[model samples]
Target chain A: MTGPRIALAVLWKDIRLDLRTRDRLGHMAVFSALVVVLLSIALPTPTAETRPWLPVLLWVVLLFASLLGLTRSLQTETEEGALAVLTLAPCDRGWVFLGKGAANLIALLGIEVWTAGLFSVFLGLAWGPALPEAIWAGLLGGVGLAALGTMLTTMATSARFREFLLPVLLFPLALPVLVIASRATAEALDGRSVPGLWWGALALYDWVFVVIPYLTFDYLLED
Target chain B: MSAVETQEVEKRYGPVRALRDVSFSVPEGTVTLVAGPNGAGKSTLLRILACLTRPTSGLIRILGRDPFRKDGPALRSELGWLGPEPGLYADLTVEENLAFVARLHGSDSGRVESVLEELGLAAMRHRRARTLSQGYRRRTGLARALLHQPRILLLDEPWNGLDEEASERLTKVLQRHRARGGTVLVAAHAVPAARELADQVLRLEQGVLRMLPGGPREETHG
Candidate 1:
């Protein structure tokens, strides 16, 4: 009905669709688990000896898996013509970006949870500075990833070779998130309570690049 | 209720002029049909009115608001659009798709069911949207656009995949919507066979617009 109201509705709709299919988010989980498995095989044993790298490993797995879900996020809307419908609503078009961004955050968070669980289980991991740091890093990293991923996804929707394009475009942009996530996570794994400067940087990136979609979304949706 | 007032509006796409010095006024509670040849700017005009794109230079107003500046959540509650795709969620069930938009507009409970029935999509309510025929898919888009009960309905090729019966049903619903003071701006190859449903006809060619009388529309029916 209103901005926030419709924003929530769009977010809910996107999540329901992705969650219902199981394939989209399912692929994200599977891809995430595979990464965890691979990391376990490559590095093997996640006792205190390997725990130092656990935070890095956790974020690496999540950054990659987030790709699978984000790429297909706007694919359905573009292919099905929902973008046009959304643009036609009396509300501003930015809500489509915001709504999709929120939905993406929810899905990415879901993938992260799965990846974290698998990492701890299969990698023999159990070490962190504090619960707050872990959650803060996760939320910060999750929000940044979703913001960057959602805009890139919208851009990819209108481009040629979208499947290839989304990954190429997303991987480079998400690199910063991975770097910050690794740093924040590394500090936590070492049991050294520290200021989350990486999270701050991540937040900075959100404000800059994520804002690109809103300012230009109308241009992108035009036929 | 005069819904749209555009004065000396000109739209150009980079080097190509989509619309040249175009202007028109559309009153509310009436169905204005737009017809044109290829690259004639039918879709371009629709985009401007929907506020998805801005004119290169001109003042265009819709229901007393500037669409370009008022967008997304602010504009969605009142505007309804059906473009070439009506792209419903391939993975979502028909009813779920309707409810998704319904819930967004805070009208989920009975809105989804009513629109589903109106579009004759009741039986396919539980079916995945991708599983439906082209006609049904189009209906879903139309249904979703109207799901919010918007004041202005900007539809592009809305009848692309509908059969006679479905077309008639859509026509009936539109008549009721128009009767209730809702404005309909349709971009199509030809006017709806229900000529009485049309209040005015506008044509575009080579970046210019020309008005066609109501009589020319009657010949379209025959």
Candidate 2:
């Protein structure tokens, strides 16, 4: 099969599985909702001083929520040694990586939208004014997270402590994405234009992760 | 020419050697039975041959091409592997699983129906894999492996969960494959039917490989 065809096959398969089982996405959604509910109850009323911190808080929630989904993304593939079937793809195994990463990207994007809505409903946050820039930040941040998370998850899938290993490996590498994304989000919330530097940084981070995984998946998918 | 060949193929998992200088060759249009006790490296050898894992220090060629090189992915397309696990998606129905594999191999979607019928899985095509019995799961897995009509089949304990009828059906499938000039390498503890159909018999003990005499084809190897 051609590269894109392989990727599409994997993408559709994962999506279909996710829809059928609702295991990964369902867990992530519930976790995010519970965390948001706790934050709404525990935090002091949203004041002008604390309002700026919301962007950081939002990104942090996303990171953790993404961790929930990313950790389980390969469960289906690993369940019955199905990963062996994926390794048999006729194209570069990198195409398989792309397919998996794309599926994760879609899932993360869905969670981002859900979390944003939850924040608006419970935290009394207004997103109307910041919609465009916030979307750009969310898109770039989601891409970086999905690419890095998918690659690291695959690498750690066979590890004994994979559940613990993913976060340890992910948090450090994902710091830049969180920093730049939160800053952009903060500016957008304040109705200020996000500087091009943050956008470039997010884009660069995404590119590096996507390219590295694409180049190294052949080895990552092997024993 | 040999369809599968390995030279000094050794596999090590931290201090423990799973395969030790195991070398063997399987000719085209033949069925080779590899028998061994549990933890006898039967699965490891099959995984190596299937290109699922690399040999620590050896050479492996599938259809005359190094399966660990740049050609490995393309070469893997011609191979159908059924490992200890069925390698299926539990939530997907039997038909969905087979269709997915067919697409991965770029095979005609029509092959999915044909394989289901051939494997007697058509009746349960709409059933989720997780809901099927073990025997049916194995049949579905075999169907997935054969979906693309691969030139080589690497099956590990394929008859484990098969009923007598399913076993007979599998025997026929192997016969048909051999008749079509395909190569088959099956790893198991002991399957009388497999022995009856085998062109060669190789025994693996403690990571060592030896050819059993009296087979139609035999080769001396370490």
Give candidate 1's error at residue B164 in angstroms.
1.3
Q: Tell me the spans in candidate 2 whose CA falls farther than 4 Å from its real position.
A: B212-222
lDDT of 2 by residue, B11-73 (tens): 999999999988778889999889878888989999988888788999998999998899887
lDDT of 2 at B30: 93
For residues A110-217, what per-residue lDDT tens digits would candidate 1 score against the true structure? 887788778778886554445567777788889888888887777777577888888788888788878887777767767777575666787888787668877776
Clashes per prediction? Answer: 19, 0
Candidate 1 lDDT tens digits, B1-222: 468768778898779999987777778888878877878998888878776667899988778767666433455466787878775778888888787777666775788888888889899899888898989888888998899898888888777889988898888878889999998888888644534566777778887876543442332220
Q: Give Cα distance to truth, residue A5, candidate 1, Å.
A: 1.6
lDDT of 1 at B220: 27
Once fitted onto the true fold, the runs of candidate 1 whose alpha carbons sit more than 4 angstroms away are A43-54, A92-96, A128-132, A203-223, B70-76, B190-196, B212-222
| C-alpha RMSD in Å of predicted model 2 compared with the true structure | 1.5
lDDT of 2 by residue, A37-77 (tens): 99999999999889988889889999999998987777878
